[model samples]
Target: MGSMDRGLRALVGIGLIAWGVTAQNWWGAIGIIPLFTAAIGWCPAYLPFGLSSCKTPK
Candidate 1:
């Protein structure tokens, strides 16, 4: 996960949590957890697949 991706994930997580709390839907909040993880540049789900977008030094 690149810096940009991490940043986006953080934003999405926050949005989902906000929506879930305000809308009274725990599911939404729960869904945001994954996004939050991705945003932080770490994805549990991607581990099995060996997926990573983080830029490497040229």
Candidate 2:
């Protein structure tokens, strides 16, 4: 994924985890999805649509 996409995902994941921790809820587990994807720079959800956030090489 592109830098912007990765950064946004990481931010969102961190936010969710923080919210979950503060609230002491299991929902915080959901944050792993975005966090993992961001770390790997890949999102499985984007596969079927053939979408990509990374810029193409010139």
| Each candidate's clash count | 2, 0
Candidate 2 clashing pairs, residues 3+ apart or interchain:
none
Tens digit per residue, CA lDDT, model 1, 1-58: 7777777777777787888888998866675775767755688877999988788899
Tens-digit per-residue lDDT, 1-58, candidate 2? 8999999999999999999999999999799889999999999999999999999999
Off by over 4 Å in 2: none
Winning model by TM-score:
2
- Listed in order, each prediction's TM-score against the native is 0.71, 0.94
TM-score of 2: 0.94
lDDT, residue 20, candidate 2: 95
lDDT of each: 0.76, 0.95
Candidate 1 — which residues are off by over 4 angstroms?
35-40
lDDT of 1: 0.76
